[model samples]
Target: MDYLQYAFFRNAVIGILIISVAAAMIGTYIITRRMVSITGGITHACFGGLGLGYYLGISPVFMAAVFAVTSSMGVEWIASRYRIREDSAIAVIWSLGMALGILFVFLTPGYVPELNGFLFGNILTIGTSDLWAFAAYTVVLVTFFALFRRTIIACAFDSDFAQVSGLPVRFINYAMTVLVAVCIVLTIRLVGIMLLLSMVTVPVLIAETWSRRFISIMLAAIVISIVSSLGGLLVATIIDVPCSAIIVLLQVALYFVARIGKDISLKRPIR
Candidate 1:
């Protein structure tokens, strides 16, 4: 609780919550639609955005957002039309993006200290500006999701049928890609690029087994993520562990408990 007294700590907490809500909401669709790998791909590609930001000396978040969206679109275009497997295409793009990011960083003035921060995240270092940016982005994401719920649900459950019904499947897919890009970019400040995948996947994984309805899953995911965020902050504060790592650990523990509960409930007693 004392840790929360610091202004930056407070901002960090708010930033993390913003990230959790966005990740949880979009994560539901990502997991249900089997786009988990793409989440990672988009995350790694944000490194290229980091590099671009370094080169341009602008906010990395801005460059990351641009790179993530462009990369997602590129992956979508290739996956939609080419014979290449989605996984293969993702891997190819992921590698190329990272390579370019490294080149850009190395070419910059001095060794970038923020590079490592972007890799693993440094939530405790969040600033007021970051908090505001996160809040604004979250609003945009929520509005996007709310307005496109029907189309997204249809496409997620059945793309071929959505296309047959003239639901603008391709456009919706691209829009989802943009949302994911936003999600990835939003997270870099809170969880970093390397471990952002956990925030995107863990809550959704727990909710999937516990809830059957979409709204229920999303609500559960949000609750789980918020709890994990608080727990992670406490654990990191007391133990001096990295905030992002603690967050992932808390999510893992929750997943195990959920799994264990399921196993116990499914067990049969001797007759």
Candidate 2:
């Protein structure tokens, strides 16, 4: 209970809630469009920005956001206009980003501190500034979804049909890709690059087992993420384990439970 009085703990809670909401909302689109691999590529690509930031003495999170957005848009351009396969583009960017990050970190004069935190996450490091940035992202994501739900849905399910229907499919695709990149960067501090993909994918998978509707999945994922994150935080604090790892483990455990429950329901006799 005394820990609740600490500002860092409060900030961590706020940051996780905001990240959970954003990741859930963006993850629904990623799952629906089958862009999980693309999202993973973007998340890894942010490491380049992190390393560069360390070398340049700037904020790594900001640089990570820049790298992620650029990588996402670059993938879109290369795949759509340059005649490269999407997966191929993701692979190129993923490798290049990691290589660049390694080079930059190696060149940095001093031993880079806090690199492990970005790699594996430490919720206790979250500060008020990070919370504000997350809040801003959440607002932008919610506003975008609220204003263009139908178009976004159409694009996610069938881009060709959406384009034929005059829904600006290309524009929606670019916008969502950028948003996905931003969400990845924002949440990296929570779960780190290594485990960030699961933060976006696992809850959505569990939610999908129960509902096919996009909004339902998003809401369910948000709830599941919040519960798991908070519960993991509590357990990690008590056990003195890595918070991010604990959170991911909790999410995996929930996924199995949800899967089992889903299977049991499917086997039950109809009334």
Candidate 2 lDDT, 1-271, residue by residue in tens: 7898999999988898899999889889999998899988998899999999999999998999999999999999999998887899999999999999999999999899899999999889998888999999899999999999999999999988999889988889999999999999988889999999999999999999999999999999999999999999999999999999999999999999999999899999999
Model 1: lDDT of residue 59: 85
Give residue 123's lDDT in candidate 1 (0 to 100): 89
lDDT of 1 by residue, 87-135 (tens): 8889987998899898899888876878888899898788887778778
Reference-based TM-score of each model: 0.94, 0.98
Kindly provide the TM-score of model 2 when superposed on the true structure, using C-alpha atoms. Answer: 0.98
lDDT of 1 at 192: 88
Which sections of candidate 1 miss by over 4 Å? Answer: 268-271
